[model samples]
Every structure is written in structure tokens, then in C-alpha cells.
Target: MSLPHTPLERVTSIKRKLIILIGVAVGATIAVFYVGVKLGAWPGIAGALGGVVALAAVWFLARGLTRPVREMAHAANLITRGDFDVRVSAESRRDEIGALARAFNRMAVELGETDRLRRDLVANVSHELRTPITALQVHLENLVDGVESADPETLQTMLDQTIRLGRLVEQLLDLSRLEAGVVPLDIRSFDVETMLQGAVRESRLVRPGGAIAVRVDPTGLQGVGDAERLHQVIANLVENALRYSPTQSAVEVRATKTHEAVVLEVLDEGPGIAPGDAERVFERFYRSDAARSSEMGGAGLGLAIARWVVDLHGGSIRAEARDPQGCRIVVELPTAIGAA
Candidate 1:
């Protein structure tokens, strides 16, 4: 993460240390000179020279001690100026100061990550909010200008847009609660097939013209999870498929028991997700250019929410391109006892 730029306080700590070192060095030299003069061991001039050498040695030692301090101060200033990349190269002398420097570097790295995530969150939220709001505004303005009458069809379309906006708001609120750890799961054991059937049935009701199909292994795959949330997960995936697949193309939902888990897949004949975008598609407010412009109703939070629900249940979900055409989303969850 990039460090923020801010001015750092000047380092005045070295001044006090320099004063102490100079005073000690001067006092030791004076004492040696006085002793030499009293003992008459050598000429006074020779004793003065020896004292000078001793003071010089003290000065050199003081410089050695303060050099690292000077470097550290410079680094701190760079960091304060939002340069998190700056690092102190002091050796691991097993000293407290060295440890503190290492810890400071780590904290900078974490702060950068936090800042990046915060920016992404805000951008994604804005994009998601704008799409539906813009659509509703345009439609409302047309009606106000008498471009569209209050006919049943026009009124119904406007009502649908309003409902879509409301749903988007609700989904955003739900996602916020889930991310904040405020939503608790009602975990229990249930037949995965039963849940899948219900979700497929509901989706069919909404897109009756779509040729969506469901297939199950019928081996009675069971899982421990919040059934309601799991149902939502299935519905979201299927609905996504419905939105992307061409009219008359089939959206398939399938489930089978793996060795250690139950795998559920929603496959569609729509243009497959680009390999580069497979993972990012699960991110909040991420949509392909085609999907973004399509009339499918969504705020781009469905996949993110589904992933969260699966994660809460100790499961995993991933998307991959299907052979020849389309994309497949696979969800794996631990199988209930006696089902494996």
C-alpha cells in the first residue's frame, strides 16, 4: 500500500546526548591532566597531548553511537510524509530500537492495506448505487414531461424500477451487516437437493420464458448450514445465469456428492467469464461490460453476498469457464453425517 505523505517532527533528541558525551569527555581529560601534573610523571606538555588523544577517542565513540539515531530520524520523517516504502537497514543487533523499527514497518504495511480496501469499498458502493438510481431518474423524468403516459404498462415499468431500487438498498444493508459480523446464521442439517429444488422453482416463476433446468444425482446430498441462506445462495447463482444466458438457452443447476463434500454447480450457456475476471467477478460491484449494460436487475452484490454466506458456513465457491462455451460456478460444502 502507498504511504500517505505527511510532515514529520524534527529530531532534537540527539542534541541532549551530544551534550552529555562532550561533558564526560572534557571532565576525563581535565582529571588526567591534573593527575599528571601532580605526579610529575612527564612533562606538562606531554600530559596535555595524552589528554587530547583521550578526548578524541570519546568524540569518535559518540559519533558511532549517534549515527544510527540520525538514520532512524530520517526514516521516521519519510514515514510521516506518507512514504511507507522507507525502511531502516540497521542490522539486527538484537537491540530494542531495532525491534521497534521492524514493528513500525509492519504497521505501515498494514495501514496501506487498510487504506486500499477502504477506497475500493467506497468506489464499489457508489457505482452500484448509481446504476439503478440513474435508471429510475430517467424514467421518472420522461413520465413527468408527458413523454410517457400513466398507462398500465408504463406505470408498471416505473413500479418495477422502484422495487428494484428498494431491493438494492436492502441487499446493501444485508451485506453491511454480514461484513460487520452482525448477522448470525441459523445452522442446521438439511437435504441440499430440497433446497436446490425450491430455489430453482422460485427462479422459474420469475423468468418463465427462460429454458432453465435442474439436475441432481439423487444420492441424497445433505449438509449442515442455514437453509434459508443456502437457498438465497442458490437463487442468486441461478438468477445470474438467467441474466447472462441468451433467450431459449438453458441454465443448468446440478449437485453431486464428492468424497468429502457436496458440490453444487450452476452452469450457463452465456458468454463465459474471461479467465482474468473469474475471481474478480465475485467481488462486490464487479460486472462484465455486457452484463452491466444488460437489462438484468441487480446491484452487483449478489455474488459477493453468496460468497459470504458460503464462507460463513465453512464452504467454498469458485467460477470457471465451461468447455466450448459459458461459465460454471461451483460451491462445495461439507456433507452431513452418513451422506459421504
Candidate 2:
């Protein structure tokens, strides 16, 4: 592609044109004065002065148009040098060049955000993968050196660690697919009560001794969504609750109908999220201080995946502090009329 003219070149061209015009007018005026002096006419000098004034007006007009062009070129050069902070302030004009400058500024902002996210992704993924790998290596080394024998419990512990690693990998893959827009939702109408019941039953299996409650309104509430994906969303939330809450503490899964949507909440009697972590908790590989050090069998992508599934169904999910203590995760999906 051909490169466009730089602002400096444009300014130089305008200056050159002004000089040439001035020189031509002066030469013509000299020629006229010489002829007029020979012919005894005095008006030729006045005509030449008028030509000079007209040339000055043209020069000013050229400068007026090129000012923004120069500023835009400088901003472009800064951006080319990887300076995302460069901004063009000439957005007031309605011309094509003004629109181009606005678009360039917007692109720089997006590129900056993408770069930050890329750095965060690399750091978080490295940290997450390192933990499980390091644990597995230590255990294997102990067994090899006879520090710990291959007892049944020791074998089982190794098996659990390996399984945790597999699960983490699987979650990462799922999140990647979700983000890539390759996971299509299988939309259908399903009763919310049945879904919650299944999730609560499954959660009980995971935390056998934990006290859990499932509360749903008698009037059936229904919603349109991908049943499998929605089930995963609920299961992940409940599993998260069970993993964090103190053993024997009550975990509640409740569903209620609002005017336009059905709200399903998973509430746990655990230490609530820290003040600044409520939003970040849903990010992939993010963990609050209380859960970060624990050997929780998750890669911290559960909430992120849940949010994606809910968003696919045009719904919302958020974390809130429960009354007195603990955290409540609320999921809201639009209810289908006359569906049970």
C-alpha cells in the first residue's frame, strides 16, 4: 500500500506554493511597472499590491487546514512507537480526517487493554499450573527416596493431586472454548425446581457430612436455557459453596420467582468475600486470600464459566454479602411465560 504524505511535507508544499505565487506576482509587477513607466501609466503598482494581498489570503487559508493534519501525524508517530497514551484532541471537526483520528484513538485504548489482559493471563496461568505440578513432583520425589512409602493413603493422595491437575486443565479448556464462542447453547425450557434439586443432591455427594438445604417456591418457575450448561453453572456454584464453608455449616440453594425473571441463589455460611475481591472473584484463576492457599479442587474458572453461560442466556450473575455473614451468589434468568 502507498504511504500518505506526512504533515511536515504537506506544510512544506504549502509554503513552497506561497513562495512561488509571491515570486510570480513580484516579477509580473516589475514587468508591468517597467512597461507602465515606459507608457506613462501609474496604476500598475496598485494592481500588483492587490495581487500581493490575495496571495497572503491564500497562504492563511492553507495554514488553517494543515494545523490539525500536523497534530494528527505527530500522534500517529507516537502510536507507531508503541506509545498507547498518545491521544489526538482534534475530534471537533466533522470531516473524514477527524473521524480517522477518533478511530485511531479508540483503537489505541483497546490495544492497551488487550495488552494488560494478556500479561495477567500469562502470570495467572503460570501460577496455577505451577502449584499442582510442584505438589506432584514433591510427592513423587518422597516416594522415590523412601521418605514416604507407597502406602494406600499415600497413593490415594497422589491420585487426588493428579486428578486435580486434570480437572484444572479441563476447566481451562472449557473456558477457552467459551471465550472463543465455540460452545453453543442448547436452549430449552426447564423447571428450575428440578434443576436445583439435582444440584443439591449432587453437592451432598461431594460434601457428604456437610449440612445443605434446598428451598424452592411451590409454584413452578421455568426458564429458557441450555439445560446442560445451566446445570454446570449451578453445580459449580454449589460446589464452590461447599468447598469454602466450614464442615457442617449450612449451605442453601434457593430459587424464587420475580416479576420478569427467576433468581437462583447459592448461599454459604463462610467468610464473605473481601471488599475488593467480589468482582475479581469471577475472573478466571482468581481467588480470595482465604481460599487461595487451600487445596481446593478447582482452577478458579468455575465462576467465570458460570458467568459466561448466564450471559449466553441473556441473564446476570453477581456475588453479594449475605446477612450477618457469608457470601451469596445470585443468578437471574428470564422466565418463560406459561412454561412449567
lDDT of each: 0.76, 0.77
Question: Model 1 over residues 80-144: C-alpha lDDT tens digits?
Answer: 78776776654342345445656766877877777778899888777766766787788789889
Per-residue lDDT of 64 in model 2: 46
The TM-score, computed over Cα atoms with residue i paired to residue i, of candidate 2 is: 0.77
Best lDDT among the predictions, by candidate number = 2
- Encode model 2's per-residue lDDT on 1-340: one tens digit a residue: 1123332233334456557556755666666556666676666665665466656654544444556678778977887887878877655444555577678779889977887788888888888888778988998999999999989998888887888888778888998898898987777788887887787777667666477788887557676777778888998888888888787888888888788888889999888777688899888778877786776546778999999888878889999998899989999987652342
Please give the distance, in angstroms, between residue 33's alpha carbon in candidate 1 and its true position after superposition: 10
